[model samples]
Target: MKALRVLLLLSLVAGSGAAAEPAADTGREPFVFQSDRIDFDRERNLVAATGDVELAREGRILRADRIVLDRNTGIARADGNVTLIEPDGEVLFADSVELTDDLRDGFVEQFKARLGTGSRLAASSGQLQGGTRAELNQAVYSACEPCADDPSKAPVWQVKARRVTHDRVEQQVTYRDAVLEMWGVPVLYSPYLSHPDPDVTRKSGFLTPTVGHRSDLGVRIETPWFWNIGPDQDATFIPIVASQRGFIGAGEYRQLFDRGRLELSGSLATLDKKPKERARSGPRGHLRLKGESHAGDDWRLRGEFYRASDDGYLDLVGLDSSETLPSFAEAEGFFDRAYARVGVFDVQELRSGVSGDTSPLAGPELLYEWQDAPSPDGAGRRPAAGAALHRRREDENQRVTLEGGWRLERFTDGGHRLEVGAGLRGDFAHGDGAADDNNTRLLPQASAGWSYLLAGGMEDLQMTIEPRAQVVLGRNSADADEFPMEDNRAVEFEFDNLFALNRFPGLDGAETGQRIDYGVQTSLHGAGDWHVDAGIGQSQRRKANRDAPEDSGLDTAVSDIVGRVGLTAGEMTALGYRFRLDKDDLTARQTALDLSVNLDPLYFDARYARAVGVPDPQKPPGPAQDKEEREQVDVGLGSKLDANWSVLSRYRRDLDTGRSLLGGLGLKYEDECLLFEAAFEREYKVAGGDPDNRVSVRLVFRDLGSLPGTQGVLPGGRR
Candidate 1:
């Protein structure tokens, strides 16, 4: 019956506030001196009540066998199984308790308090001064609000501190003789510990370490120190140390500005590589710098820097060969509006140790535009529209270009279309040697063109025809003087849509030339998502001086035709073919063929090309006007696959050398926290360049902290 009564009494006082009122002295009955079952007395003006006494005021509740309230002073004391409850559902129990208003300052010989947020705090005996401070000795805190008697079974761990003082303003807790325990077992102890509060707004701390292995570098490790400086800025210092090719040291710095942010990284290694002669390479280093900024009115600046020792350093160290390093400086600036842009570009090479310095690539270009339409959203419909003036120089001679042109591109719901305007551009140059500025005749140049598109036979099947014409009025055109004139002819045909209908990589200039080009194209679909597209075109030109290569049947001809057909099967299958003809001789001048296949877990791409020069052409016996020639071919294949892991490979063939030009392969594997990759490739050339191989690895971790009770290493206590 006593236990039941005790349990009932606790239920009534749980989560209740402490209540104790002072007695009045204005002829009052000492608040209370006697009751039917209790007695009260005033000794030395100290109001004392005894026997099943219970006091309740405001929302606070106080219960005990005896209570003392000193009316003359501002203090209250409760003895024998005393319990004090606050309005916020925090209950405090102790053998004896004393408190002032606001609970700002309190004392309990033995105390335990349970807060509402699944947390509990306790100490043998202590004092709390409002939210700003708390001085505790031998305290234990935990996220778990354990059941009354099974604290060991709580789901969370607790941090124990011998002496701790917390500062609410700074949201930090400093402690001595601290121990972090889980299920009653102390996993860690600290003579002194300081950590961000549970509600700390600014988290500052140390970071975790990174480790990895590379066949070339052996082992690498790094630990970074992070500083939370303040709200607007922060920084970290990371020291990277690695073994394999001697000791390598590295560091990185980053900063954020009001208008932009910048990041810079650099590394150095002594005796880093195996040398061909008596000693290994001296000290080597790599640096990368980047930044981006924006101003008002569409004005922006951005750039990056990448440099290193001879390219071989990357290959030997298993780094990316594709990482092109420019020991030179290349800078560009842009100022623009929606319809116009002005820009300047400069390149200065720093490789020479000569007595003088010069910039080889320096130029300023200006272009203006007037438009009355919104820009197209697709790349195929993004046509150029402007007139540009540029100056060029080679060795000592210089020339200028004055060209004006217009192009219109639009994509309707059903198809795409383009209309291009031609321009008359004249190049005037002078040099010590007439051999430098090819054209001496000051040619009269003019050009114009139009193209159309029409769809038919289902949405997937479309046909397009682009017809173009250009007329030039003059040319000395002498084979002995290959120059004294520019040779702008046809282009080497490739998959690039840039000037697609115009074949031959522009080898000879078209002057005093009249040519009509006809292009007919079509696309079809079916089979493993197969896609087919084909096109054929023809052109013709005339020269003022017949001494031109046309006499060799390789220059100006009555007609030349080119055609290509290609098909794509699903994500991995492809096949293509190309052919060119010399109309005057009715013969073949070029031919090409290719095939490829790709699948998710697998991939492949291949290509082949050939150019046939006119060694001899018998203009079709009588008047038929058609010729035939030999072919020079170039071919390559690249592929990737996945089984136990992923792999990549590439192969190339150069018929001109009757040898393979290049080939390569690579493999990789990765998971949530760790990643690794390695590759070996070779690019063969009759002269210059070799196979470049590379390897790389990376790892990520979480909840990394200085100690169990400290702030996490990450920007946040995420893990």
Candidate 2:
């Protein structure tokens, strides 16, 4: 039963406008009261409400079985299932409560609160002071979700504190004499602990700690502290302690500005003593520094510097496994159709019998590139130009190289293509007790090719078959043996590079004789989300370069046959294979295969690669190229057993030696408010090296602050 009722009582009170209005009245606001049954005692200046009583003002609501309000004293007493909801959507429930005039200061017994972070707080007794502070005695807090199947079951994790204080204005919570409980068992305790409210974006605090064991470092632990300098800047400091090694410290700092951001991180340590000779030798500790920055919208900078106190320092400390660290700094910029970059690079040797003087260094490297838009004349021709300067140490001599080139390509309507390119490069050699001299060479190249697409296959299938041929000519017939090989050493023969003027990746080494490159390719596109592509190619050198790598597939008149095949089935599976076979015997010289599949709860991937060994033809052979074949296989799997549990595993093995290289297994569990994971792994360092074992564990509690309450219809209360 409901009725429309309105009461407007206007009375001039002492030093105020209207008596029936709120205390801080703006004269425009009104004070309304409603209940199932309302009765006023004029003699006592008191109002009593029963039967689902409710009082709402300024977005704040108070509901209880019964409530009594004294107009003169401005105090409200609520009994029987009392609930108070704040304007910010927070809710509190208590058996009984007494609130002051402004509803700011109050006391509650057998109370519980639900915060916005999904965490809950329950206390035997609580006090609200000044509307911005709350004090709870003998309280329990938990972020874990209770079992919906059984309301009587306890949460997975919780924290009990003798006393807790929450400061709404500062957005922080502090606990004293706190105990951390897992699965209803107390596992950790602290005298004092504090954290910013979940609503806080950044605050100073201690992050989770990590503990692990390594063969060289033994048992080790790392604790990190985070500091928020400002809204755009922050830093973290981590201190590491190990039983076998001394203390080490690592830190990282980052800042954001209007134009760009900067980040710098590093780690340093001091050794206890020299390790035994039988152990991995080299540095006693490691040093690593890295930084990156961006300026404006078109410019960027990056740098990396890493070094080890000894050969085993990095691997033992679990920082990195490489024995050689290359340090470099580069800056790059982009324009409308042009790009420019400059950098300096050097290498650090941490291995035994390696000297710094023997390692090469590039003091300064510069490059620029530009491209012209397609010709408006409809020839579909594009012109591109590039230039570079490199100063580095090569073969105990100081070498300097300056080079530039331009290429023009024209495409015809009949699928015909023509390319013309020319370049002039010079090299100046000096220092290292070598005769100062300059070697200049001019390179001119041209190629032509034609292709046709033959469509209309079986059942809406389309097929394309294309055969292409190209010929490249150079001015110098010296095979580039006179110029020091600074950058281009390893060359891979593939269909993509079949018609290339130079198979080498860089300008250091150039192909110097006439050559004919040709290939045939076919592709099939089916209607049922299936496709197949395959190609076979080879190169023939009219004049051979005896100085080239023997198995590089480019030194003989008839190079090895390079072929590739790829197949895909929409989004479910894919497979690809590439191989280089000997021209005479058709024996595989280099081969690789990759396969992947994704089907709901099951996923898998596998890769295998084998590179045959062949002795270096140019250098006096110490270790034959095929002395130890490079063959390995890698595979991984992931399966979701149910809604909250998943299993994952990965493995890598040396197929030739039948030895396990690396393997790991992991299990993970996650629910609404909690996540847990554990993993075990084994890693084999290098040839003849023993295996290293490792284990890791992690846990996360989501929605760290929340509370429970009954259903309500207030403007901002739970729906």
Candidate 3:
């Protein structure tokens, strides 16, 4: 009943801008009076201006055909062509107006107002509760046309309301039955709405929701609610609605301290319940921590932690789209040219994993890194102090790493350059246990480099070629036996990024022992925006101590060959190839070739790989294992021909078995108002000729004038 009464009163007030007011004081003589006459009424203690009359008090001016002032009420009533001018450069006109001496707050009928700043407003009935605001019966707000000398006639966008209550203290207006209008044409309407007048502090309201679908998760719906919690913190709750059945929710919390900021998010419920039954679910969560702060003039502190509840949990629920999440913490800063850091890492428990299984491992890793930037002087550069400490539960032995490196670079005239570098390293690790334990030692370290470059060409032709060489001398005590190994994850965050012409994620692992790597690389660019480059190298490892010990698995060798080549035409076509050759057998141990092309809106990529004597990853491992030579070929096709549609397709085949291993497709639709997408993929097997995994995806979004269910969506139109 109260709400209804409020609504009823608002409706009346919106449509009616007229209100009665008492007459003003008549003791002071009016500065100006016009028309037929000025009448003084002693009995009523009122002064009246009749005919085409005008009255002035201080800087306020009033124009009306007739005016009456009451000494007791200090109110002024004007009829016919009533206008009020306040001290603050505001001119107000109305058919009938009742005002106080100050005119800061009052009532008016058929009100039309133009303020000091040229912003205009109008209402049929209203009450000016304060100097800069009013409770209007109906009002319009806009600044499309400047209210110049004649501000009343300016063009404007309006907000029509049945009733509007404007609060100067909060600088906002609340309304019922509001419609958005432009040039007097209604475009949108809403039952209730609120907006800040111009500038204000924190305000709470609804936010837009996102819609999408995943093959495994089915249809997806997420609506987020925002909370403006105090001044230093805020939060948002996003609820996910699944078509299949179940609610998965997520939220983010943020807070700021004097030294740092913190943010975290985790899912509370999920739709999939395969590996973990719903009974045991929702207890799992993830954590992340990162911060940076100044400690001294030249030293700083930084750290990052990323980890998930379980390894497969994120993959199953799609919480981790990147497939791999590492939980690690490190703190390191620099002083002058040198730097160092130490990090501790732990693995995220994998779902459906056996209690104690090894293999399929990267081993264990602990890293201590150091680096130094070069100075402008011609003095020799400094070397880095680095180390790695690692051990695996699967293998008996732990590992230790110590290394240092230095390099020099100089640019020559005519776009030429040169560089030289060297390094030393040592590694100690054991495998197996006690008597059966195998100890592997490497007193191996050496490096050298002499490289050159040239870049000068015709208007359309440019080229460069460089040759490099390095030497390493080291010894190895290799009685390391391979035990069932499990934990091995090496994580890196560095400024000295490695640049190579191969797709191998860990190419640096093979960079040890005594060896001299020599290679010449050449690059050419001519007409048609085409480019080509290739590199060939051979490594000569140290074996000077061969006569001192019996034969072990570790054999110091001579030159082993490695090379890579690549080419790209116009901006549309590309090709790449790389190979590793064993010096003892003169056979290529591993080879890969890839090709890609873009036909305007269409693009495609094909790749082939062969490991001459290796077994397939899907096959069993044991003595006398049936090792099907590892060979594979894959292709991907994607295109966006028109503005509204796009598609992507991928396929992979095992050449040796003549089998299709994988295939997938993705499609999308986009336009001015709506967006839609769909995707499907399958993981196939050879003998069964059936896919082991299948996936599908979809998403859609619409633009509404304002966020849904928000008070800002006046006129109820899409924003």
lDDT of 1 by residue, 318-400 (tens): 33334234422222234332233333333322222211122222223333333334445321111121112222343433333
Mind giving the per-residue lDDT tens digits that candidate 2 earns over 56-98? 6556678888878776666778899888888888888899888
> Which regions in candidate 3 have their CA more than 4 angstroms from the true location?
1-218, 228-234, 243-245, 255-260, 270-311, 321-324, 349-400, 404-444, 451-459, 476-514, 540-561, 568-600, 603-641, 644-719
Worst 10 residues of 2 by lDDT: 710-719
The number of the candidate with the highest lDDT is 2
User: Deviation in angstroms for 716 in model 1?
Assistant: 36
Cα displacement (angstroms), candidate 2, residue 513, comes to 3.3
Provide the overall lDDT of each model, using Cα atoms, as 2-decimal numbers. Answer: 0.48, 0.69, 0.55
Task: Write down the TM-score of every candidate.
Answer: 0.49, 0.82, 0.57
- Scored by TM-score, the top model is 2
Those runs of model 1 whose alpha carbons end farther than 4 Å from true positions after fitting are 1-244, 250-263, 272-282, 286-288, 303-359, 364-400, 406-422, 426-445, 448-454, 458-512, 525-530, 544-564, 569-596, 599-602, 607-719
